[model samples]
Target: MDEWLDQLANTLATTTLREIHSVLKRAIRQAQARDMVLRNVAALVTSPTGTDGRPSKALTRQQAEAVLKAAEVSELHAYVVISLTTGVRTEEARALRWDHVVAWIPSLKTWHPVTEVGFKHRKFAIHVWRADREGGDTKTRKSRRTLELPKLAAQALRQHHTRQAVLKLKAGEAWQDHQLVFCTSVGTPLNASNVRRAFRKITKRAGLGTAWSPRELRHSFVSIMSDQGVPIETIADLVGHAGTSVTEAVYRHQLRPVITKGAHTMNTIFGDSHHG
Candidate 1:
């Protein structure tokens, strides 16, 4: 096992190595429980550090804008818009259903005519309740959140819905409605490869390199919000992070150092009262 791992070390990444080790150990443990093996030899094996993998990157504001503009005319426009604007994970977006898309109706202090209430006056929102994981739950319990859509995201989704309806009519009997917001032409669920290929095409049209992925839209969302000085706690909640620690760790590059807020507040209060 060590020899085989050593041979793969040059090509595999550290995280991949750890995952392989974990799977092997679990299999061995299960076999032992069934009395198939006298001892779990895989448990004795430790995960070795492997080659470094590609580093994650977040897009700049200009790049994000370019991508959004390029994707505007593409079939995946709404998918890209929601991912970038809401900081939703790609898996969650893929599993999203039209039923989960809601419009927030604000309460009026005084009675208003029913005719005055319309979709135009409502704020669009999405409930992140499911993903491509087992049991159809989000990555974590905290990941199930409701996010108010920005203008661009709302517009994109509205347009996409109209387009999908047209396609549904065109398909006729072939249209299988799983209610997915994003899906194949026949209304089947889209695989990761399908999304990756479409994303790469969109990036290429936007004059971006081939290295970009759908996941980076979420990263761009984090970076842009952080750059705009949104609070870490708020960003965490928006991105469906269990805590600020995960948000900070995963998006360390996107986060601006917050150390100066205290100094600035102190300066405002003290105003250089003491001499040097």
Candidate 2:
């Protein structure tokens, strides 16, 4: 005989009230998109106290180590390695080619390649050499960034190249010329889903739980860098963020300690100890 929500809200716990409010808000937003609702009724309600809902969980360093160790013999190990170490997007790592590695001096350094891009050299390499390899567009103009590869990441790439060469020999003419760093048996671009499936298999076998995903690897990268006290601006630049503000907004929770540490550093630098 009475309004159901009014009856329920009168009897509902604070947490239940907040959740009901959230569900209604989402519904209203969807309805608003179709012009069925003029305003979000849930938005008008005051949120109940002390009910922020479930927190997101991320991998601890130990879990990451376990995953990487379990993935050791997999052909896709380099993908995990690059993701964990350098925060390179899965597509960018897959899209990488042998030519992307620039040798310092042609005759001297046989297998050694550096990734630091100088203005003149990048221009020359992009125009003359890298154009030959297919699959070159970065996700965004900002994503065309050059990051210094960690030592292990570079080593993994070297091993992957050798492995691919052997694969090419076995496949013979059947191997398509994808020039991709990661590929299927016949040298084709890997669909993102397939990689995730393989990744899940390895993680499950390793007992890492079903919660792990490729995006978690990227999140791990940000967390590790954040813990190391890397500046937000520098981290943003390394990770191809458009600006420090974006990085701060997205990673604010992860960077809280870094922010606190930065404040301390600034205070120490400007404090009376420095004023002779």
Candidate 3:
């Protein structure tokens, strides 16, 4: 079975391999907890093949605009905007509530909620916990950091609130106060798959190319910031990455332009013949 699994891992694309690795890691951890194993064997394992597989893609601005326009009529349109604009993961967006989001229009600032998440899984499944919105914490300690959204993202959220209120009035007694910024028809927590499906449909309708996904929206946000010359240190803080190193390791290829510009700046500043 181990050999077969190894072969399976080798055959998987990068994203799929990551998912498999995550599941294996979780099972290994559970076995360790049960005294079935002293160490996690999967943790000892390494990917020999590397990421010579399908790379993750970020959405183009035009594609993002189309998606935003298509989702305009969706009840959760604001949530989509916030996720895409701020680079917060879907789980982070889903976990947000009215209390968590603070809009200070006078200051032209919006603060994202920060909270700790305690869990036992090696890779906390974003989907399962999403099914029961109250079940898990944020994905990581780094993920507990706060972010300030740009003015546009905050405005979208405000409009979404007014729209949500209308839906609540329509649902009347059936509206459950789940405190979620994004909810189902009757205010229950939305199924993560359903939300993804809806977004995919919206993208298709808007003629966004095949590169968009819930996660890609986040990638796009980071990429846009990078293009705008936001420092990796600041980007790390904005997106809840542990450090600039982690951000670069994960997104270097996507931020190649930023990297090039940084190199150019260094060359310009220090390349001249001055004090030997």
Highest-lDDT candidate: 1
Error at 57, model 2, angstroms: 4.8
lDDT of 2 by residue, 59-113 (tens): 5688778888888888879789878887766666666665565434444533233
| Worst ten in a row by lDDT for model 3 | 119-128
**Per-residue lDDT for 99-154 in model 1, tens only?**
77876655743322212432364477788863534345536554468888898888
lDDT values of the candidates?
A: 0.84, 0.67, 0.69
Name every residue pair that clashes in candidate 1: none
Candidate 3 per-residue lDDT over residues 215-260, each given as its tens digit: 7778888888887778888888777765788888888766745546
Better model by lDDT: candidate 1 vs candidate 2: 1
Error of 1 at 160 (Å): 0.3
TM-score of 1: 0.84
lDDT against true structure, model 1: 0.84
CA lDDT, candidate 2, residue 154:
61
Which one is best on TM-score? 1
Error of 1 at 22 (Å): 1.9
Q: In candidate 2, list every pair of residues with a backbone clash.
A: none
Task: Point out the worst 10-residue segment of candidate 1 by lDDT.
Answer: 110-119
Clash counts per candidate, in order, are: 0, 0, 0
